[model samples]
Target: MQEALRLNKPVLAICRGMQILNVAMGGTLIQDILELWGGSIKHFREELPEHMPAHTVDLCGEKITEIMGKEKIDVNSFHHQAIDRLGTGLLCTGISPDKIIETVEAPGYFWVIGVQWHPELMFNYFEEQHNLFKSLVTKCLENMP
Candidate 1:
């Protein structure tokens, strides 16, 4: 992930990938959301439908708001770990109602976004989730020499 960022490659990290991306950028994770950061919303929803919107994420970043087409969006939650300290150069773009970091973006890169939710599973139900990939692909193509 660091290599991709250094190369200015578009990186769309989802679920555990978001955790990995954070660590790769010198940030830390909660390890377990329930154990460390207790909240009303359950971060690990293995029993629920993967495509179902588990909770809402309030967004702030201009890029994310534009991509999502709204200030808040429903997303599926499937992981227990979440970003604690933001990685170097990474901006906290989205947050759950419980205050868990839901989305992050590296401003220095062309398109480096890490989403805590499983957008891949929700794409069939949410157009905004699908647009995440479309945005990444569009950035990738734009960067190609």
Candidate 2:
């Protein structure tokens, strides 16, 4: 990841990958979101139906809103840890109703998109989820040297 970022390569991080991205960039994780929220938010939907939408993440940051073309997106949640401090050049793109950072993007890179949810699972049901990959590929192709 360090090499990719240094080379300005497109990077798409999902779930724990997002966490790792943050750590690599000198950021920190919340460790346990449930403990912080004190069980208020339904962030970890292990008991809910697999396909059921867990929450809505508002695409507030400029890059993600432009890529996703929507103010908000319904996503499947399955995370207990989250980015506590955004890394250098990183911006909080999406936020859940509970104020959790759901998405982060590094504007300095050619393409660096990190999401707390598992888009691969949600893509089977949601077109927008799949579009995330399409956007990454499109940007990558456009940035190819």
Backbone clashes, each candidate:
0, 0
Give the poorly placed runs of model 2, Cα more than 4 Å off. Answer: none
Clashing pairs in model 2?
none
Against the unseen true structure, what C-alpha lDDT does each candidate score? 0.90, 0.86
**Candidate 2 on 1-145: residue-level lDDT in tens?**
7888888888999989998888889899898988876566778899976667899999887777877789999988898988898888888899998888899999887789899998888777888888889988898898888
lDDT per residue as tens, model 1, 1-110 = 77887788889898889899999999999988898988799988889998988899999988888888999999999988889998888999999999999999888878
Q: What is the model-wide C-alpha lDDT for candidate 2?
A: 0.86
**Runs of candidate 1 exceeding 4 Å displacement:** none
- What TM-score does candidate 1 get on C-alpha atoms? 0.97
Backbone clashes (count) for model 1 = 0
Q: Model 2, residue 101: displacement in angstroms?
A: 0.5
RMSD in angstroms, candidate 1?
A: 0.9
What TM-scores do the predictions have? 0.97, 0.92
